[model samples]
Target chain A: DVKVTQSSRYLVKRTGEKVFLECVQDMDHENMFWYRQDPGLGLRLIYFSYDVKMKEKGDIPEGYSVSREKKERFSLILESASTNQTSMYLCASSLSWGDLEQYFGPGTRLTVT
Target chain B: EDKVVQSPLSLVVHEGDTVTLNCSYEVTNFRSLLWYKQEKKAPTFLFMLTSSGIEKKSGRLSSILDKKELFSILNITATQTGDSAIYLCAVESAGAQKLVFGQGTRLTINP
Candidate 1:
């Protein structure tokens, strides 16, 4: 079975702090995605990488950046944390071209205060 | 802008009852529609429908899509408490490799 793992299951940060969320996949999938889930808003795409060193902005990429230095890993960076930035973050990976069904990692619930 | 919408934002019913969840979408160069079940944490894949009238089933859950109508429905029979969770609908469009998700429907099953 494919497994996607997130760096932190729960995190707490203060406003103005820099935050980093990491995701790793064992399947070596070529596509990875980052999304933030909020109440009543569902899951909104933040950013996605189709290959190593390649990144593209999703619908809601503001205040967020991504890095894909390696094929098996992807990172999400919050420039400066804010109370409104606190939410459940999910990481997913899938095979490129075909097999669009994404496999999700155990999400990280971040809290900013 | 591509958009997906789910109906009956919340539903509660007793065990063994049947329920149907609805999802509708408006996306240019439509690709496919997907359904996911999310509990407390991450959402899990349920079904991916690309063809119309072809129902996909897994035990008690079944889903079908209508390309002409641009809508889909997920039906769950013999509901269980374990089935209580948020059901999400998403759409994939051409040129957009990412999916557009709808505000999920919260379903609660009481035993």
Candidate 2:
């Protein structure tokens, strides 16, 4: 079984604060991703890392940045959190680009006031 | 931009009923399609379809892909309350590491 772990299951932050969401995978997967899920909007990709120090912007990457200093860990950074940024964050990992299956973490629900 | 669409955004059914969830995509360089069942927590992998007309089954849940039509369908028979969850469909593009997901179909099963 593959396991993807998020640092926090729930978080609260004030507007304009900085926030960090950490993710780690035990499967030694080469690809990791961050997504935000909203009602009626489904899950939208925020950022993804294919390898250490290599990152790419997904469909909605504004106000967010990611770090992949190591193969097992990926971090999502909210440089300036806002009320609108409150949502459910999910992290996923896959064995490779050609591997279609992605294992997701339990998710973190963030509230910004 | 790649697009994945699922029909019947929500459905309500009784136990022992059979249902079909639809997913269609218009993705460039299509490689595969995947189905996931998500409860209140993270989405769990259900099936992955890379070829057309081949069916993948797990207990009461089965799925088949139609690459030529750019669509896939997941069928669940003898549905139970445990089968109630948000069904998500995602497309994997060739040479890309990310999965583009559909809005998902929310299923509700009542005894």
lDDT by residue (B1-111, candidate 1, tens digit) is 999999889999999999999999999999989999998877899999999999999999999999999999999999999999999999999778889999999999999
Candidate 2: where are CA atoms >4 Å away? Answer: none
| CAPRI docking class of candidate 2 | high
Worst window of 10 by summed lDDT in candidate 2 chain B? B91-100
* Model 2 quality (TM-score): 0.98
Local error of candidate 1 at residue B55 (angstroms): 1.0
What digit string (tens of lDDT, one per residue) describes model 1 on residues A45-90? Answer: 9999999999999998999999999999999999999999999999
Going through the candidates in order, their DockQ values are 0.78, 0.81
- Residue A10, candidate 2: C-alpha displacement in angstroms: 1.0
TM-score of chain B of each: 0.99, 0.98
Candidate 1's C-alpha runs over 4 A off are: none
**For each candidate, what TM-score against the reference?**
0.98, 0.98
lDDT of 2 at B13: 96
